[model samples]
Target: MTKTQARKLPGYIFLSLTALASVFPLYFMVVSATNTSRDVLNSRLLPGTALFENFSKLVAQQDVASAMWYSSLNAVGTTVLALIVCSIAGYGFEVFHSRGKDRLMAFLLLAMMIPFAATMIPLFQMFADFGLVNSSVAVILPAVATPFLVLLFRQSARSFPHEIVEAARLDGLGELSIFFRIFLPTMRSTLAAAAVITFMTAWNNFLWPKVILVNNSYQTMPMLISNLRAGYVTDYGVLMLAVLLASLPTMVLFLVLQRAFAEGITGAIK
Candidate 1:
């Protein structure tokens, strides 16, 4: 090999190993979905012919379709609302050029350090008082204005061109019109990244939803998976199948938006 090729070999090897490590669990989960509980517990690495049987068990045990519907509703609601609210906050923070905004932004960042567990009880109580428990609103409302998403949009907005906002204002374009028409189009990648993040988080959220959505009819995919493991003698095959199904949407979304997600995360405008 050439000298340059030799020098890069170790780095390539390390990256390959890391990639394998990342993919192994997914590989195992897929394999386990096709096998019986015994084979899964035995750590069998090969795919089996029991896929249909496991799927049947999953269907028999849970309302897979209902769970998916509720999950989709919650995820879509959270993503849409979070994008709107956080993007506006971010745009105002970066574009308005105000004095107190920086201090307020810092305070929002401080709120991120506060663990969700610390506020979960109060949130539950508030929602209960509002008679929103066991509803989709209870699941989606809490996540609509997270500090992390605001920060992300704020950082991305730093690269936005303020000259455009000024020019639009000179033309008498309303603030909402500018945001919907100009800002959103210019920041498509960032929005995609934010949507993917928010959707995935809402889809996978377990604890809050578990605590709030008491009715079985409002079950989400994660809650379905949790229920699958709740029995004393868990059906590993069915559980794996449910997990695989639950994970598919987020996986597909990430795969589709991965490039934009990377760009957005790095605060790159393009």
Candidate 2:
């Protein structure tokens, strides 16, 4: 090998090992899903022949389809709403300048410091009072105004060229139109990254969904898989199947938006 190739060999080897390590758990889960409970419990290394049977059992015991649908719907809804709200709020905060606005922005950012658990009880009470409990509204409402997303957008918006805003203003474009026409298209990658993040959070959210969705009819994937545990003997094969199925949306989302996700992170860091 050439000298340069020899020098980079260790780095490549290390990266290959890291990539394999990262993928191993997912590989293991897929393998386990195909196995019976006994085989999975024994940590079988190869794919088994029980894939369809396990999936069938999973469907029989729980509303896997409904859970998938609810989870995907709620996640998508939450993402779209959050992006709209966050982008608007971020653009407004970045563009508008006043002492009062600065104070409000500070307060908005400070609100992010408080853990969600701290506010959960009050939020639950408020939502329950509004008759939104056991509904998608309950989940999406609290998540709609994510301060982190707002802050992320605001920071990213700082990099937006004021020249475009000025030109748009000269052409008599309204604020909303400028944002929709100019800012949205310019920040497509950032928006995609944010959507993926929001979707992942909403999809994988266990505690909030669990607390709100006590009724099996309203439960999502996390709750459904959790519910697999009845009094005493739980179905391992079925649980693995459900888990594999539950993971599909998030995995697909990440795969599709991974480039944007990387760009967004680098842009934010820059």
Candidate 3:
């Protein structure tokens, strides 16, 4: 092989190994979901006929469906609100360009560095005061304007063409119209990536939901999964099934939108 081709071969092998490493756990989870608890304890890697039994156990659990629904609602709600707010904030921060806004952005970055544990009590108290505790809104409100998403949007907005904005302004398009009709469509990929990240974070969130949601009826999938594992005789097969079901939406979303998500990120960085 040519020297360049030889150099690329190692990178390709490394990538393949990394991909396998990532997929291995998911494969194991799928296999375990199809096995009995005994089979899971024995680390069985092959699919078995116990899938229906495990699924039946999962469905028979009173809160499983409700928890899944609540989790889905929280994930979808948080993603939509976060994308709208953060994207707008990001676009404004980059395009408006004021010293005060720059300082605000720096403060936001500092806020991001603060551990969530530090603010957990205060956040919970605020939600309690607003009578939002035990609601999906409680899980979503604190995440709607995430600093990380704001930063992502700001970076993506850097690639937004200034000439287009100027032309839109000259054509008498209002600021909101320009943003929605012009900028949004152009930055679809970046938004898709942000949406995926936000949805995953919301779906997998445990600590905040566990703390805020006092009612078992309103618990999320992660919280339910935790409760399941903590039971006296934990059923590994059932737990695996719960995990597989919990993971389905994000997996499907990534499969459907991954191309746009990847391109958006690449474009933003470029």
Clashes of each: 0, 0, 0
The per-model lDDT (C-alpha) reads 0.92, 0.88, 0.91
- 1-270 in candidate 2: lDDT tens per residue? 999999999999999999999999899899999999999889897999999999888878888889988898789899999999998998888877568877987898899889889999998899889988899988887898888888778778889998889999999999999999999887888898899899999999999998887688988999898889763887677788888999998999999999999888677667
- Residues 77-125, candidate 1: write the lDDT tens digits: 9999999999998888888867799899899999989999999999999
Model 3 misses residue 196 by how many Å? 0.5
Q: Give the TM-score of candidate 1.
A: 0.97
Q: Is candidate 1 or candidate 3 better by lDDT?
A: 1
Candidate 2 structure, TM-score to reference = 0.94
Better of 2 and 3 by lDDT: 3
What is residue 74's positional error in candidate 1, in angstroms?
0.4
> In angstroms, how far off is 227's CA in candidate 3?
1.1
TM for every model, in the order presented, reads: 0.97, 0.94, 0.93
Question: How does candidate 2 score on lDDT?
Answer: 0.88
Worst 10 residues of 2 by lDDT: 229-238
Q: Model 1, stretches more than 4 Å misplaced?
A: 268-270
